[model samples]
Target: MPDCQHGLIADETETDDESIIGDEAHIVARSDDGPRGVSDLTPEDRDKYDNLVLLCRKHHKIVDDQPGFYTVEKLKEIKALHEAWVKESLHLDKEKEKDDLNYASYIDTIAKTFDFDSWDGWTSSLVSHGQPSIRYKKLKELQTIPNFIVSRFWPKRYEELEASIFNLKNVLNDLIKVFYKYADEGAIDKAKETDEDRTIRTRKFYKIDEWNPELYNKLSEKFDYHVSLVEDLALEMTRAANLVIEKIRKYISPKYREEEGKLLMTSGPHMDFSWKTFKVEYKTDEKKENHPYHGLKSFMTERAGRDLHYGEGVDTHYLPKRFEP
Candidate 1:
């Protein structure tokens, strides 16, 4: 039988007539003497594909000899299961091919939006103490990346990649918001006036016009905290980006290489930043506890203070330990 324990296949080239005679067993037998012959099925219906099951001679005789053991329902179930297995085996390759194309498309979209080739130049402004350095046009382009990422239909197999992409998006959005808040518009315009290249326009963090000792201390602390947060987010974003790149290389394309500096913003060996030494957790409800990018809204809106902690855990501890003059 198709689901026989012996796992035998009928060879049409065999010379034995008895071997092939009952090879095509019927669930509701065609004649009264045959197996499961008590059914009221019509002659044509008994010979139909639904009623027939392909089996070896041994199982055919066994089933026919003891029709009570292998009933019409049992044979029908066996036939259905066997056919399902065959169908899945035949289509496996086609499904894999389709998934490969989808993976390529998704990875390509991420890589293009990241614009890794110009990363170093665009991020060079951060070397000057986390200033609003990204070009206006470039920042605008970067802002659209999250939309593209969320719009894609990701497969279950790339869950980790999807997660990394979302994390990067969250950090990037925070950085952009911070830039917009503290950016010195006047400084940017003045810089554009001095520079011949219009593309060289850059923005800096706005400084306090008149410094009262107490006000200066408060604003300075907030400014420093914001700068630290920006730097930390940038590093976190880079880490997430590298994770996505690695996954793409491992799963989608082996030939893909990580871009130079891995899209990390670095001033020098001494100015490098990392999140490993400090613990940072975003606020989220129980349902979203497992999500890596949770509580992004709260993280952005939280007021900077002396403690620098937000939510349940210590969320922002990576303040730059610079020496005061």
Candidate 2:
């Protein structure tokens, strides 16, 4: 097999220099490296993505020198498929890396980010040097290492895992800022309405200003909006945290983490919502059946009404009161 001419597959051959570079093998043929050849590759792509494929000297010449015989499309397709198969077979094995110190440290990178307040932000989307918002920038930094450390490390949940976190961050980031904005400056900018329907629904929740009756009358509908927004933000954020926990559960066995004393984080402030969405009616009905009843088998007490308690058990880790950035 070592004497064979094929670089990828083993075969019977009597060649002395079976795997030697140039004469017996090619990483990517000299001709194919060109734009007009069978394999057009950039430096980074070739270096990082395993864009280069080896071939025996005989096949290398045929692949590179003759574009008609070996097309660029076919080579790219083969290279892509091969890389995928390799990842599917080895790189996605989470159980193999459960006890790996490097990987555990990598997981800590994300877990610790939540511990500190520096990566948090408002949704003003502050930009610097033509870059994305600061929060976006921070989240991006967190994402880049996961794949490099271990490709498809999160397995099937990876897609929604990233998405839910992103959404959760933005939702809370925006709501936190909006809450502060109304506190600092009584009225929101009417022109920058992003979600009018949700805003309308959120309007039924609170009354921040009591002194200015005119402004109160004008924006009374939206007084409780922050409550609804906070509740939704908490719900969405917890859903995201659950996805992360689910992802961790996928690869690492619970017994392993328990044995090793590594805490599998499922409970955090971001994963807890101590608020509720209150449904309010603009007009109070004269009919006692519409109101909440203390005791009776009346239609209002049985089906239409019951006591509403905003959920309890608040955790600040998921939604911190003070954010550094």
Candidate 3:
């Protein structure tokens, strides 16, 4: 199967768009050692077993019609990449810090993508004639990122911010759903009814006055309501992200370790790409293998997502699930 984008599920309406994967033979092509082969082959043959890719109708047509665009090597590589991500062996290392710094990087990407710090701009986008066009762009950016959605990589150690994390995640999911729903239903409905031209009088089934004085007020009220739905959720995500990072800072030691990836963001009227970077650094804790994740029996335990530990034991210690130092 083709990989779904990280941190999200696909909108099911795509199915109705005639985007079905393999409804025809020509729509689904496979590669072999050479054209001479295929007199007979077993299911275990490496060519078929190891290289299968899924594509929608339009894409399959394009790939076949333009062989240069979808070379045999490229198609196989796509399948291989998707397969590699699915084989997650859970190679847990007891020696490492519990928080996945890489996962922190992923969260940081989300914070930046949503324009978390720029509320006024988001407000303008929300109420504009083209409402959601801005947010849709951001959503597409998030989806285009590869392999960033697997929650299993989350450091999974912080317990103090469990409630906050839960609330934030739940709200963000709500916002994403509403984001699409409004775009499809509200956008179309408004466009059809919103034009200023109003003149028609006939009664086959019925004819009605289009000069409704209440249309402006109705649309304005709905816009306000729509903006609030997203605004509240985005603010909550921003708050929860900061809270997770703050918790990590409280427990991080000043003594240094090895370097990890860094985050950089751009802003301002100049839009200088180097405007700012996520300065927080996570270093290796070689001096203390147990400096983090010290006592947890399993990284999968529940205490990581709660504020209280048993009366404190080998498995209970201060940690943040979203990120490490």
Task: Estimate every model's Cα lDDT from 0 to 1.
Answer: 0.59, 0.38, 0.40
Give the TM-score (vs. native) of candidate 3: 0.34
Overlapping backbone residue pairs in candidate 3 total 7
In the range 263-315, model 2's lDDT, one tens digit per residue, is 21121122253222222211123122212121111211222231221222332
For the record, the alpha-carbon RMSD of candidate 2 to the native fold, in angstroms, is 19.9
Instruction: Report the Cα lDDT for candidate 3.
Output: 0.40
Better of 2 and 3 by lDDT: 3
lDDT string, candidate 3, 91-155, tens digits: 34332344545445655665565444653454333323323333434544434333333343555
Off by over 4 Å in 2: 1-106, 115-157, 183-214, 252-325
Residue 284 shift from truth in candidate 3, angstroms: 31
**Per-residue alpha-carbon lDDT of candidate 1 for residues 1-325, written as tens digits (9 for 90 to 100):** 5535754554555665433344777888898777688878889999898888878778888888888888988877777888898899879867777877887887777677777666545555543444435555566567888788788777666565667667777767766665555665664455543353333222332346775677777766666655655555554455556656666676777767643534544443245553223222232331132234444444443323212332121234321234122
